[model samples]
Target: MEKKNNRYSLLLVGLAVLLVVGLVFTVGRSKKPTLNVYNWSEYLPAEIITAFEKEFGVKVNYDTYSSNEEMLAKLSTGATGYDIVVPSDYAVSIMIHQDLALPLDKEALPNLANIDPRFLDLYFDPGNVYSVPYLWGTLGIAYNKTKVEEPVTSWEILWDPKYKGRIVVVDDMREIIGMALQTLGKSRNSTDPAELMAAKAKLATLVPAIKAFDSDNPKGHLLSGEAWLGVLWSGDAALAGMENPDITYVLPEEGGGLWMENLVIPKGSRNPELAHEFINFILRPEVSAKLAEAFPHGNPNQAAHALIDPEILNNPASYPPAEALEKAEWLIDVGEATVLYDQIWTEIKGGR
Candidate 1:
């Protein structure tokens, strides 16, 4: 009886030890640091995140959204615990005004000085108190050299009836409507009902020319030879050109939209320290060069230019001349004019 009682006592001690060890392990894992990053789909390189995670010894929960509006919706509703977010152009202003973005710690970001001065002090973010410009590009025309004979310098070429059924455009209302407005010599952010209505009228005519409205893979159409010419973002155009050397990208002489996607910390971030670290990590010239090499966007990190391939850095489509941007306009929040923008898109797309 004594021997049996000792065995039971020993079993209890071992069980207690196991429970204590299990509790400690569980708590340690629970306290393990994590960063939640939300960004545009395919905007960030996979290796970049891996490098950050490896360097920091923390897990990064990366998520993506297709549009700035989608990202804004999740953040503005306070539905997410996202630590880092990338907002573009006017979306930066919207998030700032809505208090969705928190001020960045400049001291934590010493590498911020590496940014191009030309990309800084814009109307969207004066002094960049709340955001850091990450990648930027322009909306322009991409055409097949073999298929297109006419000069592709102007937006007017898109409206030519000869190219009907061979042109593709981004599905976004702002991009399409913005093009029409720019073509008409009006502001892309035009709030005037008359100007918006005029753009709406002109877009209806373009519907016949548009073979399809695809934001996801407009390049696919362009590469497949289904689309001879269409409007595309500079980064997408660059990618398309790689797949098919015959494709040529040009910034319209009329000046199209210029957009910059920036890295920002949202309000209520769980890990502000790590978020700042990640932002600073991205600003590192080598890392920025890696991102530019993978994404082919207009990198704002001037220091990284030396590290980037001359082919990408010198590509006129990817990096247009300064004069092209002199007349370029950054798309901004048109206030209530978004209603008009929506109506125009709905009316045009609804008919189709």
Candidate 2:
């Protein structure tokens, strides 16, 4: 009986030791680091995120916002937990001025060498201190070849009476008004109230003809044959072209907005080093090429250009000719004039 009791006591002690060891292992293994990324909707490919997770064993919490304004408003509220953000060129300038973005550590981003020099040290975020260009594109017109009687080479095609109720315009106020401004031979960043009013008037005149104002999925309308023509970002146009070969993208004769979406680390990030790691990961030639394939945008990574699909590389919409690029203008921070733009845009949308 004494020997049996000793054996029972030994079994209980062994079980207790095993339980403690298991708990310690579980706790240590469960504390994986997380990276929170806020980006534009549909901007990144799923495989990129999956690959990053697999490589680093760091969990990614990805979220998306539609516009720069929406992202800025959320960040302005002092809400935390975002380790990275993707903002456009002008928005980067605003965030920098407002001290909403953090300076990037160049040493950590050695892969920055892959980016083309042409995209760097721009007027916005000059010296490339706080942001890195991700994808760039022009705002242009996309038209279904079967629906349009005439070749669409100009922005004036939107105002044509024949296309009434068959046109889709981007919902973005800046982009829409910028198109009008460009058509009227004025700067997209025009602060002149007269120029803005003229642009608003033009838009108001065309409003009755417009089928819908859509940003999230203008390509859907075009694909469904609901909208015969649309003012779209070049990337969206490229997507439309791929899904339906009948669709064609053209840079209007009047020129258009050239935009560069950039990757930035917002202030108060919990994981700055991880953010840098992710940026460098994205900048890798192969990864950058994959991003271009997914989004069909103009890749700023020169090294990645060689790795892109030949068909995509040859597509004029994805890589506009030199003349088109020469005519294109980048949207710049217009300072307090933005208030006037807001007012004008409201008037246009309100049908005033």
Candidate 3:
């Protein structure tokens, strides 16, 4: 009886030991740090994240969004836990204003010098406090030359009777309205309620001509010949031109919209130091050059520019002429006036 009792006791002790060991193992694995990043779809080079993970001994959880508003809605919910995000210049301002961004620790980012000072301290995030500029480009029309009778040099061509039912523009409200405003000799960032109304009225006229308002893949329509002309970003234009040589990108004579993409750390970042490290890694000359090769946008890194082919820099559609650069205006947030912007945009898009 005594021996049997001892065996039972020994078995119970062994079970407790095994349970403790299992808990320890699980805890160690769970403690391994990770970072969560949310960025625009098709924005980053493929292997940049992989390289970052390997170099830092950290795991990266990456995701993508189609538009700045989509990202804002998700981030505002406070459950996504995204540590790093990339938004355009105006979106960065909105994010900063809404307290969605965390102040960047400059010491962690040694490569900030690689970015052009000219791009820095713009109306958005002055002194580069909350964000770092990523890629810069203009909005323009890309069309299939074989299908288009003449080169499209004006935003009005998007509404031409000949191209009706064969045009796609970005789904962004600001961009669509800005295109009309520029065509009408108004500023892209005009805060005047009257000018916005005029822009809205002009856009309403072009609504029937649009096949679709697609921000994600407008180039697909042009490439597939479903739509011969599109209001497309320079990167998408570059991709379409590569897919078929018959495609051509044209910057409007009226000075189309200009924008900058930026990298920012979210307020609740679990790994701010790691996020900064990754940002610096992306800013590296060789790294930025590789990104430009894959994405084909105007990289703001001077060192990267030196590495890329001169022809890419010389591409008029991507870089634009010196005079156009001087005339272009950067977008800024109008604060409480967004309600007006939204109302006009909704009215135009919802009319038909």
Candidate 4:
């Protein structure tokens, strides 16, 4: 009787060990890794994220911010655990300097060759180390053609006293000030204290004429016809025109800021592989085209551009011709100049 009991006890112990191992394996397989993406407000199509979730069986937690500074502040805390982030050209440079991002592993992304070479090797990330170009466009004026009597081709219209309480501009400091600087025949990325101050003065002249400083939906101002003219990103202008064709986009004679938004991986993410997969998925021509169709931004994917509707592709406001791109200046990080720009912006906006 004693021998039989010992044999049964041993068998029961072995079954317990097998059950524990099976439970561990099942738990591991059940927990799908999550990918976190932080991007600009209204920057992406909703369906793309859904599609990624469906295909990869991973949950995507997407969030957005209106400004680069806001994004930086949240990310500085290191608690967000975001796997991917999309920041504008200058912001990418700043993040890289502060060690907020990781250098991408090029071997993992074979689709890197699809990006236009013109956008590659930018001053921000030489050799495209930390970021990949997502979209590129110039800052231009969007105005109601029916309200304005003449052709608008200059930044001066935003300052016109005749349009007092009828003008809107982006709330962004660099972009708003850049418009003024470019109007004064200076680079948008100008580091000269005197030039920035001059730009401040120009902005001062337009302040009272403006209705409100808006960032998220500058197009709403134009669409409602509450403001006849506004400074708009090319994508916003295109969206506005779709609702009202009378809204016209104008590139100033003195040139405007040419901006590019890019995708980057922040440091210490939980799911770098999943983030890479998301990036690769978006780079696919069809997925890229869907983003362009949804947001109307200037897509850098040449293959995606072919997939977009001809009317959208032909839209002057959204995709300005190569000639217009020639005179425009891409914004570069201005190290110490950022503080100066902020001071001037504070003085102007605060009316001090």
TM-score, each model?
Answer: 0.92, 0.92, 0.87, 0.89
Indicate the residue-level lDDT of 211 in model 2.
94
Q: Give the Å shift of residue 92 in candidate 3.
A: 1.2
Candidate 3 clashing pairs? none
What tens-digit string does per-residue lDDT give for candidate 4 at 1-352?
Answer: 9999999999999999999999999976888888999998888888999999999988889999888889988888876799999989989988898899888888877777777788898988999888988988888888898998787878877766779999988898888888889999988889998999898988898898889899888999999889999888888899899999999797887787788999899988888888888888888889988988888878888777788888888888878878877887777877888899889989997996
Better of 2 and 3 by TM-score: 2
Going through the candidates in order, what is the number of backbone clashes in each?
0, 0, 0, 0
Q: Model 3 Cα RMSD, Å?
A: 4.4
Q: Write the per-residue lDDT of candidate 3 for residues 1-352, one digit (tens) a residue.
A: 9999999999999999999999999976876678898988888866988888888888989899987889988888885678899988989988988899999989989899999887889888889999998999888888888989786778888777998999989888777788888989998878798998899888888998889889878899988889989988888888788779888887788887788999999988888888898889998999898888777788889878989877777766677776776766677777777788888888886783
Q: What overall lDDT goes with each candidate model?
A: 0.91, 0.91, 0.85, 0.87
Could you tell me which residue pairs clash in candidate 2? none
Tens-place lDDT per residue, model 2, 1-352, is: 9999999999999999999999999976887888999999999999999999999989999999998999999888895789999999999999998899999999999999999998999989889999998999999999999989687778999999999999998898788888999999888888888998899888899989999999889999999999999999899899999999999888988887799999999999999999999999999999999999888999999999999998998887799887978888888878888888888878877878
Cα miss at 69, model 1 (Å)? Answer: 0.9
Instruction: Please give the distance, in angstroms, between residue 9's alpha carbon in candidate 1 and its true position after superposition.
Output: 18
Better of 3 and 4 by TM-score: 4
Residue 89, model 3, lDDT? 91
List the candidate 1 regions with Cα displacement exceeding 4 Å: 1-30
Candidate 1 local lDDT, 207-253, one digit each (tens): 98899999999999999899999899989999998888899898888
